[model samples]
Target: MSIADRRRAQGFTQEGFAFAVGVDRRTVGRWETGKSSPQPPQRPRVAEVLQMDLDELDALLTSTGARPKPVRSAPSAYYGSGDPDEMIRREFLRLMALSGVIAAIPDDEAEALEGSGDDFGRMNGHLWQVYQLARTKGSVYPVVQSQLTALNDALREGRAQAGTLCFAAGDLFQLAGELAFDANRYHDAAASYSLAASASKEIGAYDLWSCALIRSAYVDLSERRYRRAADTLGFARRIALRGDGSLATRHWAAAVQAEAFAWLGDFGACEEALDEAEKVASLSGQGSNGRWLRFDGSRLAEERGARYLQLNRLDLAETALKDALTLAPLAAGHSFRRRGAVLVDLAAIGAKRRDSEQVMQYGLEALRLARISGSGYVARRLRAMTVELGNLGRDRHIAELKAEIGTLAA
Candidate 1:
């Protein structure tokens, strides 16, 4: 028997079993998932909670359990028993799901995944960290989709912690939207963000809702509908205001709003929004969860530089971009994406000044980082940079840069 089967046989929910054993619920989940085992000190408690001798517990922990059949096979005589037509209908639907004609997870399997809010929180946070650090973002997609499916099951069942689970759903939706946005699938990203916003609103998670709306606005921003994005962001600002003041949600929203303002050539409005974003520095530890909201003020300089670059203020952009490169995180090589972005912006400044040498200097550095990280984000930015390099007019080195970037992005 696996730890999961033993725990369930003891008539304990995963969360309840963890409480009795005096460990975090996710620890039980890890144990059951065969990812980890209880330490020597904790084994006694775990054995006691499962009502088993220590030796039996050890054997259970080391053994695998039978996988449940997704569609149960009825007994030979069941066709003659109660409500045969209803049974037939249920079996047919299960068959369809099993055949991949429709999406569904077996009820038993889905039920086994239910846990407390902290479980989802810890899982989502860990997955976010993995996604952010992963060399290829697509590698994280399968697990996110699997988790989301299980989460939908939990929601459908309306479990005891429905509201908290809904918050997790909203956060996961935002993550899905991020993956889509990073791939430049604006339509899909917008749909995910909209669902995220709805989920957040259903649970009164103001900050999450505001962040979802801000992300949704990015589709508009990417489409070059500056006024529309700005308007959407204005509403997001109000939504953020209703959230916890200590969170950096409002500040992050303001920073993105600055971008729309910059693109629209409203210097005063852009400056005011930037000023609002600066307030994030006043909050302790940048008031970020490092998962759902990773503002942390680390990229504020880069953001300012990018906004200025958009407005073609090359000198101002150059100054901020250089400052961004000097930030502790970037200098220590902690953030590949941000550093690449700032470098690209610097290269664009060089292009605007018609200095091929300067352009090559920054562009080559950015290209090297992209190659190392294999990040879709860096490749996407490079795709845009190719346009500016084209305007630099027929230099051999420039052509090499363009070819390398195209191949990398492809």
Candidate 2:
């Protein structure tokens, strides 16, 4: 039997086994889904927790052929170790060429996307993966623009499945909005997000549709259109309620609503939304395969710090941001951009308090992390710090920091 099956037979729930094995329940799900193999670190523990011999556990997994190939941060030999950079360049060129050809074709005359409807669905899914890789590497704008052009052309030619095409279009526009928002191009982000919402609505992808709305609301918040943002996200909340509530959709809506409430200085509403967001903790660390669910409770501290910062409650901001800094992982992963933003906010609060030393320490560290992640959003927030610095002097340190922010210039 598989480990999951064996555990069930032994009368242990997946969660029960996961707790005993020192991993998230989603980790168990990954094993069951054949997306991961148990690491050496967990071997003895797995054997002990499941009451099986080490060799027997190994035999069962190996014989069932359910074990995943071990993952690597870098490309594997099975893909024939080409230079990663070179491979990326080649793939980029290939995608660009395809996009160019599709663009040049006359809309009514162009051939449809080749293959069955399932093939088109899979292609759309693959495009989402491509989008993710580009977003992660921090220069996705061009790729997304290219892909969007291709998809648009396909739709014009009637070459793509309507559902797949609309979903892909929605996703691409959302990414464009994200790229623009990170750059502090609020108006541009709002336009792209509007397009995204329309596309998602076309296909009835409620989760994606709500996500686009929430993204647009962020632009309003950044522009200090707090009332507009709150109104917009209220619509999003209703749509999210209709979605699968798998922690992702619910907590994401709650988190953004929390931000909007905080910005409006509605202390009661802000705390209420935050309390709702806190419920996400009960369902934390549950994402698999890097899905776009950013609502994990890991960012709760950071979000709280941001709220306090907006209120100019320096002591509270300091404590929350410090906790966030401690909880945030050192390596580049999901929360890197968020933690950097929190740190920048904390630094800004310090600046308001005339704590130059605190500003230097937190601001520099936040800048370093933001650059490493190439996060446009965090970089833009850092720009606001310059306004906060406000003639602190032509002091060499302040001037140097300004120059550094300039380097991140869109």
Scored by CA lDDT, what does every candidate get?
0.72, 0.65
Q: For candidate 1, write residues 1-410 as lDDT tens digits.
A: 67887788989998767655656778778888777787653554466567775567667776744221121223221111112223322332343234332123343322232223467777898899998888666567657766666665555554435556556767887887787666544545676788778767765677888899999988898768899999989999998887777889989889999999999999899999999999998987558777778887778888999999988888889888888887645557557877888888898888888889998999998889888876656766776777787677889999888767755632
lDDT of 1 at 331: 53
Deviation of model 1 at 87, angstroms: 25
Per residue, candidate 2 scores C-alpha lDDT tens digits across 159-191 of 755555655656667766666566444545676
Residue pairs with backbone atoms closer than 3 Å in model 1 (clashes):
none
Q: Report the lDDT of model 2 for residue 211.
A: 84
TM-score of each: 0.70, 0.64
Off by over 4 Å in 1: 1-117, 329-333
Give the TM-score comparing model 2 with the true structure, all chains together.
0.64
Off by over 4 Å in 2: 1-138, 283-292, 332-336, 370-374, 390-396, 399-408
